[model samples]
Target: MHETVTVAHDDAAVVKMADLFDPEPATWGLRGDPYVWAALRKHLSGKDIPASLNEVLALLHAAFDELVGLDLVTEPASSVYREQYAHGGMSGGMIDLDAWRQRLIPLLTERARMRLEA
Candidate 1:
């Protein structure tokens, strides 16, 4: 059986999408993943929801590239080095690009499209 879902088109929906950043998603690939989440949250804060999925995706990709300092969507790298997040010794400031593209981004997009009202 397939569940029906509605995509909310309001500021509250935008807020919900932005909230997806906090509480630190469990599916992070590296130590610096939380840093990226924070950055994404900041990027999406007070932002309007795009009219089209493609537009929203483009906005998300731009934010991701800006935070990670590389165009993961276009370049598709294994990882990217970040000096700001380098404080963590284990990850060595590297954010797993594939994880963001394959996992986190999709999760965020899914949430972005979810209905706020029952």
Candidate 2:
């Protein structure tokens, strides 16, 4: 024979619901394979990012999606790149691949760090 048990909560606990569901923003962390950066860099070589923020974001999204579709990069990495581009800023202007490479170096480094840690 087996017995089942039930747990009960007091009304007072509900008062602290805010704490139970903390609103603090989580720290940003890389969430993908670092090697993806290398692949992206290679793919982007000699190409330029569009001057328009919208265009740049769209390009990145598409490129990342294709990489994921081809299994070249993990889905998580693509997701992280999407998030990064969204919050990167509104600044937009035609930038060569080298310039874009410099800008994304930090993100790539972080991704590498996360990969190492994992």
Candidate 3:
């Protein structure tokens, strides 16, 4: 049994939200994923967190879609090629969309919730 927590959308709250990725995730979907995450954090740092969790989710998803050039929710289990983020020898600039939706998004959401409780 869990109660819904209302997320704060103030400057401090949003700063904390964006800082969730400060240390970066332990694992990534592909070589360029870290670059995408870096870009994603920079992108999010400027915006205000929405009041509702759903809106927060939408905000994150939309940012990811914009930076990755594909919507993870509708896209199939495939990788998107990004020349701008290419650095590795193989699979450079290729990002795993499934990992973003399944791993990153949920991780951010959970971090948000934890922040609320703290």
Candidate number with the higher TM-score (2 or 3): 3
lDDT of each candidate versus the true structure? 0.73, 0.37, 0.79
lDDT of 1 by residue, 67-109 (tens): 7777875775688778887765778678888888888887777
lDDT of 2 by residue, 3-23 (tens): 989778665422211221122
Q: Write the per-residue lDDT of candidate 3 for residues 23-101, one digit (tens) a residue.
A: 6789999998888988888888866555567877888889888887788889886678889889976989988777887
Query: Model 2: how large is the Cα RMSD against the reference?
Result: 16.8
Model 2 shows how many backbone clashes? Answer: 0
Compare the candidates by lDDT and give the number of the best one. 3
Quote the lDDT for 62 in model 3: 90
**lDDT rank, highest first?**
3, 1, 2
Give candidate 1 misplaced runs (Cα > 4 Å): 1-17, 116-118
